[model samples]
Target: MKALAHLNKYLLKYKWYLVLGTVFTIISNLFGILPAQIVRQSLDLVKDTLDVYFAFQGSSLQSGIRDQFYTTIPYFGFLILLMAIMKGVFLFMVRQTIIVMSRHIEFDLKNEIYAKYQELPMRFFKQHNTGDLMARISEDVGKVRMYVGPALMYGINLVVLIVLVISYMLSVSPKLTFYVLLPLPFLSVAIYYVNSVIMKRSEQIQAQLSTLSTDAQETFSGIRVIKTFVQESFFADKFRAGADEFKKRSLKLVKVDSLFYPLVMVLVGLSNVLVIYVGGQEIINGRLTAGNIAEFIIYLNMMTWPVMAIGWTTSQVQRAAASQQRINEFLNEKTEIVSRKKLMTEVKGKLSFRDVRFVYPDSGIVGLDRFNLEVAAGESVAILGTTGSGKSTLANLIVRMYDPEGEIRVDDVPLKDYEVSYIRRQIGYVPQEVFLFSDTIENNVRFGAGELTMEEVEQAVKDADLYDNIQGFPEGFQTRLGERGITLSGGQKQRLSIARAIVRQPKILVLDDSLSAVDTHTENVILNNLSRIMKDKTSVIISHRVSSAKLADKIVVLDEGKIVESGTHESLMNKGGVYFELHEKQLKTEELS
Candidate 1:
């Protein structure tokens, strides 16, 4: 029950509807008991009238008794019919008000979870799988709704019905009421035991389902690799194993759940039998009338549903608690990335890294050790580094993807002091690994820039040297792309990513080895176009080839997460250091090719 406390705000938001629903529930059940009493009284009235008729047979009183029976019987029957009709109407209102409100709350909860996902840091995602998160959003959320809806409704109904029905029974005969309630305590004990077992089984079932979802999602995403490696049988067996485990856990849950209804029904049956036996003896002793016995039995039957509902409602409560705990765990997570500072104006692209240090969270391996760099506004600086030389790590720092030990600044404002959104908005980043959405080329290029014009998109496409290739396609910009733009070649994908970045017209551009797939001729053409576009903006280029770095105003070389050289290309070539060796090797490799 404590697991559901977080939903209190939503519950309060729709308090009026729930209140109205509760009122209707009470009214419906109140009328629900009247029909049984009516039947009992009508039966007694008929039994006495028949006696009077027999006593007065062939006498003047016989006609009068028959007349009385004809008038009274129709009136009693109409009263019963009226109560039933009213009960049905109020019951409908109860369902409409409370049950419908739960659906509305479910909608709000789904949206809130999605917003939280957007707000969380990248590190949170790295620690959680996509499939498990998806299951949380879908399966776990539905389970929580069950707690709010049917479980709440039935639980409340049981309480109200029990109180009213028991009071009436006690009024008729206290001794009979006591005997009828003998089995209730036992029923409660059973419910408690079943609740614990169901909760544990529910957790296992949810976990297995998450594993299955993850397996299926991963297989679909890596279908190409699976086919290439001929590992279909391997994945199929893995899926079958997951399915079997899921089934076994579910069956265990079903076996436990299957006990609840029978246990409740058996207890109710015994109570009913005890009522008949005890009440008949009381009637023979002249302590109670037959009409009183009939009325007591009617009230006892009324209590049956509430008692049976105990077990089923307990199952719902336990299942909901387990799901709520899972959901609350995620909602309570502390987000590492948040924007609390306010920037007065749009940021300038003067970037600097001062003694910055960083380590990957999982491996505890240093990604950057006391790294330092400065790039003034409106300058192009190229970084040349080996595979593990921290080039991309530096680019990620500028975008505030991760926090490091020392200060990073833009326009003299510390990165943390400036608004995170403002900083990211001012930079256009093209990472080495490109990811394109499954959409038309035009929409992909203008994804984040919702208000971009066709002319602006065309200009960006031309600048990235992708316009000519796109023009050759039948649909041109409207051509739809496959997942991750699989329909395009490697070079085309890189250029499309570049076009996406340029369309934003950001203050700073970071191309982290974004052109590795292009040939030298095409790379030169794209670089020439970029030189013009980058004239009045700061640009950082990460590249391995000297040809790509030669056009920059200055070049910096990184080795093992530290700067080894920094100078103009010609000056570095003349110095015969690390940069000189890389340039010479690249020249020889090109000559041989």
Candidate 2:
């Protein structure tokens, strides 16, 4: 219940809807209880009229009394029917206001969660899995909606209906009403026990649901790997085990849930028995009439559904509280990365890293150690490094994906001083691992800049040396790709990623081993095109191949998170150290191929 208090803002936001729904609930209950009174009066009328007919049995006055009784019974039946129709109308109004408001709140809540996801830093994503995130926004939010809509409506209905029905019963015969409500205290005890059980099991079920969703999502996302390794049976058995656990828990929950209605029904049956026996005693003493007994039974039966609904409403509220707690966990997280300043700064592509140090937060692995570098405006610097030598870390820092320990500046301005969004917009980065959307080729190329024209898209494709291959396809630029661009070859995917970056015409361009998938010939052609395109823009090309580094204005060699060599490619080759050895090994491997 305390967890559900987070929804107070939404309740306040749509306060008018709740107010109207409550009013309608009251009016509907008023109409609903009126029929029981009508039944009582009708029964009493029949009893009185029969006595009069029997007294005039041998007289002509008996015929007139019988005719009047028949005429009056139809009027009471009509009133009951009219009351039901009015109650139905107000019930509809109750749903329209409260139920519809729940839907609006669901919409608002989902959008807020998604927006928070976007605002969070990459480290937050690393800590959580995709399936868990999806479950919160979809399944969790849905449960919360049930609490706000159906549970709320029925809860109000239960409270209001009971008050009106009980009031009428007491007015008719206080002694009979007392006996009729004696079982109610026991029913309250049953509800309290059921509510505690439901709350505990509901949270367990939701947690398991997230785990199951994650398993299924990961299995589907990596189906290719499973098939390649022939591990289908292995994954199937794993999934089966998880499903079995879910079923076992669900049945436990169902067993408890099954007790709700029957327990309510038994209490209701007890109340009815008390009504009959107690009313009979009162009648025998000439203290009550048969009409009073009939009225008491009618009122008790009218309250049956609302009383039964108490358990169900409590279950829904408990489940909602559990789900809201999960959603709040993510909503309360504050992203560490945000703009220190709001003003946008112009970027001219000058980069400076002074004693930059970084360690992976998750693994505690040093990515860079007191590394220093500089690049002037309109300069091209190519970084050559072995595996695990911090080349990609440098690329990530330039894009401000993760801030390093020391100073990093773009255009002589501290990276943190510029608006995060503004700084990211000025850099065009193509990562080592290419990821493409399930969209058309043209759309993927223009993903960074949606406003790019078809002509501009084609120019970028040509610049990446992918124009001829694309033109060969029947759909050309309109060809739709599969997930992660599985329809295209690895080399093609990399080239497509390059086009996506260069299409932005960013002032600072970074290609982080983006050409690793392409053949040497295709790589040379793309590099030649980039040499012309990046003549006036600062560019950083990170790779292991000397062929890629040879055309740079300056070449840097990194080893063990530190720069070991920095000079022109020819100068480094002349030094005959690590760079020279790497060049020799690559040249021989190429000659053999």
Each model's lDDT comes to: 0.88, 0.91
Give a tens-digit lDDT track for model 2, residues 1-593.
88788889999999999999999999998998888888888988999998999988999999999989989999999999999999999999999999998998899899999999998887788889988999999999999999999999999899888888888887888888889999999989988988899888988888888888899999998999999999999999998988888888888888998999999999999999998898999989998888888888888988899899888888899999999999999998988677777558678999999999999897888889999889999899999999999999999899888888999988788898888888888889999989999999998998968597788999999999999999998999999999989999999999999999999999999999999999999999999999998998999999999899987899999997899999998898899998999999999999999
Our tally of clashes for model 1 stands at 0
Let me know the TM-score candidate 1 reaches against the reference structure. Answer: 0.95
TM-score of each: 0.95, 0.96
Residue-wise C-alpha lDDT for candidate 1, range 1-593, written one tens digit per residue: 89889889999999987899889989999999888788878888988899889998999989999998999999999998999999999989988988888898889999989988888877788888988999888898899888788888888788888888888888778999999999989988887878889999999999888899999999998999999999999999999999999999999999998897898788888988988899899989988777777887777777778777777788888888888788888899988666657664676688888999988786687878898888899888999998989888888888888888998888888888777776787889998999999999999999787698899999999999999999999999999999989989999999999999989988999999999999988999999999998988899999887888987889999988899999998899889999999988988998898
* Model 1 accuracy (lDDT, Cα): 0.88
- Regions of candidate 1 where Cα sits further than 4 Å from its true position: 591-593
Model 2, global lDDT? 0.91
Model 2, position 24: C-alpha lDDT score: 96
